[model samples]
Target: MADDTGHTTPTRRELTGRIGVGLVMGLCGVLFVSTARISGGESIRDESGSVAEVLRERGRTISDLTDAAASKRTRIEELTQGTSSSEDRSQLVADAVGLSAVSGPGVRITLSDAPTSALGSIPGVTPDDLVVHQQDMEAFINALWAGGAEAMMLQDQRVINGSAFRCAGNTLLLEGRVYSPPFVITAIGDPDAMIASLDSAPSVKVYREWVEYVGLGERSEPLDEVTLPAFEGSLTVDVARTG
Candidate 1:
């Protein structure tokens, strides 16, 4: 196609095609630049790295929380030490946190595992049913707490906010030490109230039923006077103060 200067001019179809291709290329370049700028020069991450990134973030969060807890504990201890009358504060700590000996009227509840031959003798008894479980002990302790117990002892150790026991077969692991059956829990409180709480707990009811069926040992007796020793283990906690 010729113009005034006698040059071969491009047809309308060719001109239109050229403009369309130029526009498409320009739009593509704009999008690529915009994405790069938004991403701050980082490559787009795939799903493979997503989980690792999340885990790292969680670890950092947990570390921060642990640091905060330790800081608060230190602050609390500092404040506690700053108070006047050190002897009175010490007595309060001893009395409230089970750090001192307690003597009062309470009840003694003992739990023991069933006999080896009794497992097969019972109709629906399994190996687990023939032994005292940690939960059973937990139920008894919780019942005593609910019954207005002032002081408690699990075995020879004072039961505090930090006491924990786990069942390993027919024995119990309590705060790094292990002991066999016939676990004793003595609580200084009203014996009648404690007995009523024990009888009313659903878990205790179930345990009693198992005792009847599988011959698991359980005994409860009121004591006219009982004395509980102070906790002997190392304690770095401030349970009573915080509470």
Candidate 2:
């Protein structure tokens, strides 16, 4: 046997150690893969939740805007329906106009005068002093609403909820139409009440003075059968896109 010079192979203890190391390495690899998967899944979930929340908020906002628009449309419809009788229509018109007049049971105020003062001592009125400015017109319209006018029309243009009264230079721009001096603003309301409300407004008083002194275009004409036009404009809300 000695002559065979047999050499012992690796012991069982040594073999066990090699096997253990391999097992530990395998476990570590599995743990790393599991962690990575969990992290990635969580990121995806967060992104999805964020997108859903944003969509919900947008839906809510759109719904609110739609409701408001619908309400306004309904109000307009109620106001525009024709009255049963001409007398009723007249009364309705009277009530509305009452809330919008600048003076008495509805007064027609006219402003006209000589351009220049005569010899003793005076100067000619400038163009600015003669015409009503945008602000003046706006003030008058706003006062009408405060007074109780159900509806209003400037010249032939019907003033609606979305109506914008604007002035460019000395000319008035309303609902895309332009009018020169002596602009007519007609409203349907109580004649006396409308005039009272108008007189109550400080701005109207100031304008009245201007009409008397410098001859700015004056307020006038409380016609019993004055009719205003229906509002003509788009009523849609524009939404912005999200990237």
Candidate 3:
């Protein structure tokens, strides 16, 4: 395009079209870079990607497993319907499967980590000092059982013969489920004896000292009635080797 009488100049329409194409190219370049970063995992995740997402996925998996286990148990019950001494067999199977829910006078004990500020205020106390460990939970459960708890529950699930308690950071993982503080353990037994047992274990003693020094939380209450839900996860022996 030519300006009147002399120098050639681009028309306004030509200039605008070139600028628009340039902008589009610039945007495309940016999107390309962004996509490369995402493909490289730099933009999408950190070293430990989405712990919350992993936990939610685990929760969904556990739910599905529980439902499948329940269906299998129902099938087993149907198959065993007319077996010898059916009533006795059923009772034995139910108890063995941790399907029986029990209620009676019990003692409820809760253990919780100290607040961060509380731990910070204490001299020489680390963050670990403020959180309840798996050992602490095991101590209470063992003591309660030794004190004659007919049935016990930890965080609403029945404590079966093979139930395991583990600690993942500050959270409690019990029998394929995760729980956050405060962890509660209820035992249907002589409340006095249960509480006494909890108070007397060596680990429990250490926990109490931390409770005094670091402000960890501990509470025990006797209840006239407390019922624990039946264990819902698979009871199938995952590993079996003939002796």
Candidate 4:
């Protein structure tokens, strides 16, 4: 080593001593850094914990968290499936019970009372024979149902499982509402099938006979699309029998 002014130089022993001190200081620094890194919290070990013990604790915590996350994910999936299934079932039930509107290819039937002028046109004919009756509507309803009708409507209301038709004079009484002829019955299904059922039903045949004999007004037409409203009346069916 030379002095700052280049006027003095270090002896060989002095140079050797300086080199040893530098080596010792470098070793000490290296040792200090290594010890601090081994005990650092981010390196999986603190001052009080060994390397193996720290690694084991961290592995267990990671496994537990992973298991907990997997369990919650499974429960969430189950809940999602259950909710969708319930909604699908509810929709099916509503459609089956006529509590939901339906639209599709169908048939429409109109039944009206005969004109007053036709009252005496047929022999042995009475006033009842000139007008549509509850039985007439019931027969048609039954025929439509037998024809695989998905939904049916009478007048402006939907026909459900417990639909009851009653007549007052020449007007139709249904579900606490009054309707005058011509009464309309609409069914949503295969038009060809429903028409076949209407043609084969005995009761419908009887009504057709009346149509031919007394001019009782009856007309059937196929519709490209027919819509039926949901039933909005009471769902009760009161029955009485002999005790």
Could you tell me every candidate's TM-score relative to the true structure?
0.62, 0.48, 0.75, 0.61
Q: After superposition, how far is residue 188 of candidate 1 from its true place, in Å?
A: 0.4
Clashes of each: 1, 16, 0, 0
Tens digits of per-residue lDDT for model 2, 1-243: 123468656777989999999999999999878877978746545555653355456546655765576578668658866756864775565454331223223323333332444222335556566567776776677777787776676766556665676655555555444555666677776666677777888988888887667655564566565555444344444566878
Candidate 1 residue lDDT tens string, 1-243: 898999999999999999999999999999999878877777655334764355456546655765576577557657778566985788689899886789999999999988879766767768988899999999999999999899999887788887777876777666445567899999999999999999999999999998988889999999999999876554656455543
Candidate 3 lowest-lDDT run of ten:
41-50
TM-score of 1: 0.62
lDDT score at residue 216, model 3, on the 0-100 scale:
87
Writing each residue's lDDT as its tens digit, candidate 3 over 48-142 gives 55765676668778878888987887798788777679768778877765687667899999999888997557688888888989988888889
lDDT of 3 at 78: 86
Enumerate residue pairs that collide in model 3.
none
User: Per-residue lDDT tens digits of candidate 4, residues 151-216?
Assistant: 999998788887877777777666655678999999999999999999999999999998988888
What range of 10 consecutive residues in model 4 has the weakest lDDT sum? 39-48
Model 4 accuracy (lDDT, Cα): 0.82
Candidate 1 Cα errors over 4 Å, as ranges: 1-84, 237-243
User: What lDDT is reached at residue 63 by model 3?
Assistant: 77
Model 4 scores a TM of 0.61
